[model samples]
Target: MQWIAALPMYNIAPALADDWRALLGAVLGRISPWLDARGDTVRIVDPGADLTAFWLRDDVLLSQTCGYPLLHALSGRVQLVATPAFDAPGCERGGYRSVLVAGAQAGASSLEACRGLRAVYNDEDSNSGMNLFRHAVAPLTSGGRFFSSATKSGGHLASLRAIAVERSADVAAIDCVTLAFVRAHRPELAAGIREIGVTASAPALPFIASKRVPKGLVDALAAALSDVIAQDEALAGRLRLRGVLRFTEADYACIDRYEREAIELGYPRLA
Candidate 1:
């Protein structure tokens, strides 16, 4: 069995390694031994080596992901295994939102008020920071007049910092998950920022696996995750993962509406 775990190539903290090991050991188990016990050989691939192409590949066994672009990229090749949607179950039902934050001095009360101001986003492919930001502001702006400029800060924390410390951008939209994680682990980072508005909610991040994987194995993995969350307090504290919610089968088609609407509004730059 060939299993690969994909993670973003950003400035994630070193402590994430311990979290990964714990998750793999607890949720995925020793893949080789687990598979060998059932007559298979397992190989773990850290495809962060080539994120863009790696995510687009069809043969990889599993990848961790969230929201539209990734789903749009890997729709037919994978299935949802588990996700953090429980925090906002309505998102899975198609009504999730993202919070928009601005610098302490911006005094922007509404999306329209921030027009012509600088902005920062987590990533081009990020749904909360990009797609939803597009969806929220595209309809309300004229061509290239919405913001004076925009920067890709790579991660939510970077975006927040850009707005709060560097004063490079007046506003940013951070995914609620990343925001919550930062608050729990690094509240100082959020010190001078305040939320002005929240975009319509969308689905949370998901753990995905190849469609070829057995249903029983997937269920086992989900059960193991629940066990890990229950048994390992330190891992839970480190990861800040509330709990594993069962996977719901959703496809890129669901988010295509947002993409199309955004495009129609003339914000065609997908990042």
Candidate 2:
């Protein structure tokens, strides 16, 4: 069967789409020899495809996924390979946090000040967009909810527009790396949004392979991922990719903890 790969978490906007494509090409280039030796072929898929269906495909050779779905819906179906380290704020040691953002004119000084405002998020399954936002708001809820209403904006950039440009919502949680990318590539949009705070940290989104890929190939991919980032300074700087960290399923337990903590606090959903 043919194998597919994508790095779809942060490339919706036209400004940074080419950067993601460059990063994907660099990583795949590093691993091509190993794949060729195994008589394997890999193809790049559109980052704009329906993410949930794209992720679940049996022929998945590599992809990046949020920690929330990896621990919940995607558990057992995908194999963890390595975590990409990023240079953005709220990111360190291959772990990341969700950046809470409001409109540039929004005067909410802190998270608590944004009470009862409409909340926008990317997806229910997204860690940075929903899960981390819930965990942050969980302790602030009065009647099992914090926001006056919740709206699904489909993606982080869309959520940002809802807060900054469209003015339909007052708050949102975006992956810090994606926020950094926006600030660099699409400054106009970034300038309209104000970051209020960051959520608790979880392992960054990880590179994953389908269950069919063997252990040896997974290790090679991880090694190549690290080598490419460290040595390819141009690509690394462009993407803000710092380095890589190979991890097992155990390294991601804290993602499960984030959800559990939210449930314990009585905020089961991002309402």
Candidate 3:
């Protein structure tokens, strides 16, 4: 079977999709020759909204996934390729945080003051969008409830739009990387979204693969990813790319800790 390479997370925004594709194409350019030498072929693909089907297929030569699913849903189904380091604010090394945003009502206010308001999130399985946000509000919940309601906006951009444009939700949590991208490419779109606070940090989404990719090629892929950013300064700047870092799955145990801590605090859900 032919293999696939996709960076689904940051690639979702239409404003930034071409930039992601450029970087993906550059990385693939460096690595595809190696694949051809080994009698293998790979192509770049857009996995669309729901990634469950894409991730389940063993042909996932390369992909990115959130820490929540890396621990909860994916479990042992996929293995790490490498972690991409970002040069955005609220990012350090290869870890990133989520920024809690709101409109005029909650502007520059404390989380406690924003109680009983509606909240939007990218997805329940999203570490930055939901897991970290849950941990941030867990201590403020009463009787296992915090927001008057919590709804899924499907993606980080949608969450921001709900809070800023439609005004259907009072607040939402978005990953630092996506926030940085929006601020750079769609600054006006983010003018109304105020950053009230930020959630804790964990490994930014990680590159992953199934058994379809060989160990040698995985190592080469990681090295190529790390080197490409340095060799192509323009791509690096556009992608806000720093470099790639090697991480064992153990490094992501903190995700489980955040979830456990929230549960212990009586906030079992992001409601």
Candidate 4:
């Protein structure tokens, strides 16, 4: 059977894109030997691919999905493989936080100071990009909104650019890991953006398999990732693999709680 794989969420810093692909390819390559059926290559889905649709496709063998989407948009549609642990700031074990950022010229020292600024986000379904950031801003929102205007930047890196380069927005919430990667590898992109605050932590983006895949294959794939972490220190270092943790549906339910809390707190939506 034909299958596809993607890690769109963490594919920041174009310079390191090939390295990331190779690392994923190696992990998947290691797992292929145990499966009766496997693809010789991992199809790195491009930016244009509709990722929500891609996640629901039956042929998706491995892909990383945000916790918010997994709980709100993709519940029961995919099976968790494992959660990647990154050795980056704002990341703890298999959980990560969102970094609230503003343009250097905006002059907002903290989240509270940016009361009526324009806000940008990658997507509404994104945990780090939207959900967590919304929750962070909820308490500060007096009315239905806090931002004077909100725009969708299409992706985290783009959201960063919208604030720092395009100057179209004053603030945005970026995935901490993505921000960390860009700072390390593509410092130019992060030049004018300043991280002023952080959102609450939640389960990291999860590696998932289509439900159509057999349980045995899924188990083997999880084991393969573990083996890669244990045996290939160099590859794991490149991927920033700390350890893969098996997260349950309950663990993901915490994401939904964040949404509910935001609603109950009177800021149901990010302003």
Structural similarity to truth (TM-score) of each candidate: 0.80, 0.95, 0.95, 0.93
**Once model 2 is optimally superposed onto the true structure by TM-score, how far is the C-alpha of residue 238 displaced, in angstroms?**
1.0
- Prediction 4 TM-score vs. true: 0.93
Candidate 2, residues 1-271, lDDT tens digits: the string is 5688888887756746777777777778888887888888888888455776777888888888888788877899988989998988899898999999887666786789889888989998888999889999999998798888999988888898888888888899999998988887777778777878999998899899888998888888888788888888987887788988887788889877888999998999988
lDDT of 1 by residue, 1-271 (tens): 5555554422245566556555665565624445667665444466754465776664444556756755666666676766643333223332346788888878787878998788888777778888888888878877735888888987888888888888888888877656665666567768878878888766566666667677776676566667777688787766655577764645434456777887887877522
Please give, for residues 86-148, the per-residue lDDT of candidate 4 as tens digits.
Answer: 888899968899898999979998999999899999888888888898889988888779999
Which candidate leads in TM-score?
3
lDDT of 3 at 5: 74
- Sort by TM-score, best first: 3, 2, 4, 1
- Runs off by more than 4 Å, candidate 4: 37-48
lDDT per model vs. reference: 0.67, 0.85, 0.85, 0.82
Clashing pairs in 2: none
Candidate 1 accuracy as TM-score: 0.80
Clashes of each: 7, 0, 0, 0
For residues 1-271, write the lDDT of model 3, one tens digit per residue.
5788788888646746887777777777888778788787788887866797787679888888898888877888887889989999999989999998887655547677778888988888989989999999999988999888999988888888787778888888889998998987767659877888899999989988886678888888788888888898888888888999999789999999999999999998899
